[model samples]
Target: MESAELRELLTPEGVALLDSLPPYTSSTDVLKIVAGLRKDGYSASLVATVLTQAKLRGKAVAKFGDFAQRMLFTEAGLEQATRLPVAALHAGRYVRAGLTSVADLGCGIGADALAFAGAGLQVHAVDADEVTAAITTYNLSPFPEARVSHGKAEDTDLSDVKSVYLDPARRTSGHTNTNRLANAEDYSPSLDFAFGLAEKLPTGIKLGPGFDRDLIPDTCEAQWISVNGDVVEVGLWFGPLKRDGITRAALVMNAEGLHELTAATDSTDAEVGELGLFLYEPDGAVIRARLIGDLARSIGAHMLDEHIAYMSSDVAVSTPFASTFEVVHEFALDVKVLAKELKSRGIGTLEIKKRGVDIDPAEFRKRLSLSGKNSATLFLTRLGERRVAILAQRL
Candidate 1:
């Protein structure tokens, strides 16, 4: 949004009109609302800006939950903002360390700043984008301890703040449509600057989960975090923020609660063996953290393929680090034979998992012509030197 549109949207009349409107939805008749607002004499800019916010709020629920209702967002800012639950964890690290204040550098939409403030830590949120900073100022108005400002992260003075958190802009400049910056050096604050902050104070840097491990500084603790089953971000913690005795960590948060796998270094790969009675699918976070060897040893499982992430064992074990499945059938990788077998077993609903192979599951499913009441997981992979299919049931 332009500064003028934002200026108008912050007016009492604008806010009231937004609040008074019915809940925005996918089916919302935006054209009708625009026509009605124009007839009511509201300025075109105000109407357009408010409507955009309403649509954003509807989509923001996935990230902000109930807080999205009162919050304002620029599309790019909201897209880059951390999920509330994850941001709360970041804030908790500061609270647990007994830090009273934090400076949020490149604080998109003030999501982390909100968490820090909610956790009772005084926060200064800085964003380079004028409109995003304004939106953050509005989002954080509820907390007097939280301050928002428009400024470049590299220029921000951090004399008073006890700790710093940086999530550099990994996308191109814009409030709406923007392209992702693939190179870490191209990040708004730059990786060198973000990493260099550790020398001055306790710091935490949030980067993409798939960040190059080789690029990670060995001096700090690197942690990959997953929500549900998706690996989200890797956090680099320095100084007092870094936990003792932990250099690498895979943190999985789901309905099963929080599960962590930590190691001093990437664990060595487990010894490969024959296909066992069960197959184990390592969680994405675990794979990203390279602790698959540690996880395999814990569950008495071995690598199904030396080069693959899949593991298997005769022992049936329960662990949050990996999903367990009971192997039901092993057959040739031929599609025609598999279809005939599946049809004979009355298997209908199927989940296809592939590794170390090239095949599209969607296209493969159509050829199966499946019809049954039962559901099964089909694994397409190599068992030693041969390519094979393993039909299994999730445990």
Candidate 2:
């Protein structure tokens, strides 16, 4: 959004109009609301701003929950903003470490800053973009101890700050149609500068979960976080922020709350063994943290293949680190034979899951001419050099 439009949106009259609008549901609903506002003599800019914010607020509910109603967001900012619950965890670290102040560099829309301030720490939130900085200032206005500045993160003053939080800009420059930058060097302020800051002071660097592991510093503690089964980001904690004896960690947050698995170093691969009666699929966070071996060992499971992440065990053991499945059938990978077998067993609906194979599940399903009364899951993968298919029921 343009600076002028944002300025208008923040006005009392505009905010009241935005608040008066019904919850945004679809494009047709938005169009009808816009038409009515225009008919009521609202300016074009005000109408556009209200509509944009209404739609953005609806989308923001997933990240900010009820607080989204009072927040403003840019499309890119909303996409990059950390979820409120996850940000609270980051803030809790600083609180536990006894850090009194933090500098949040590249603080998009001030989501993290708000969390830190709510935790009673002084926050210096900075964003290089004018609109983002303005929005951040507004978002943080309620906190007496928090401040916002429009400046480059690398150039921000940190002499008095007790610790730092860096979330580098990983998206291409644009107000729309932005793409993610896959290379670390492409990040604003650069990974090199960010790592240097971490080495000098207590710092937390938020990076994509798929970041290149080869470049991670040996002195830092890396934590992979997954929320509701999706691996979201990998956080590199440095100096005092790095917990004692913890070098690698996987933090899983689901409906049951947070569960963490930590190791002093990366776990070695579990020994490969024959397929057992049960299959275990390690959580994405566990796999990214390189703690799959630790998880396998905990459940007395062995790898199905040395190269693959799937695990197997004869006993039925329940664990939160992996999704367990009961094996029902196993056979050579032949589509015709599999289809005939499934048809005879009255299995119609299939959930095809594959790894170590090149077949597209949807296309393969279409070719099967499936028809039956039941449903089952099919796992097509290679057992060493031979192709195999395993039918299983999710536990």
Q: Candidate 1 residues 136-232, lDDT tens each?
A: 9999999976888899999998998999999988889998899988888899898999888988889999999988899998888899999889888
Tens digit of per-residue lDDT, candidate 2, span 187-209: 99799899999878899999899
- The TM-score of candidate 1 is 0.94
Instruction: Give Cα-based local distance difference scores for all models.
Output: 0.92, 0.90
lDDT of 1 at 150: 97
What is the clash tally of candidate 1? 0
Off by over 4 Å in 1: none
Q: How do the predictions measure up, each by TM-score?
A: 0.94, 0.96
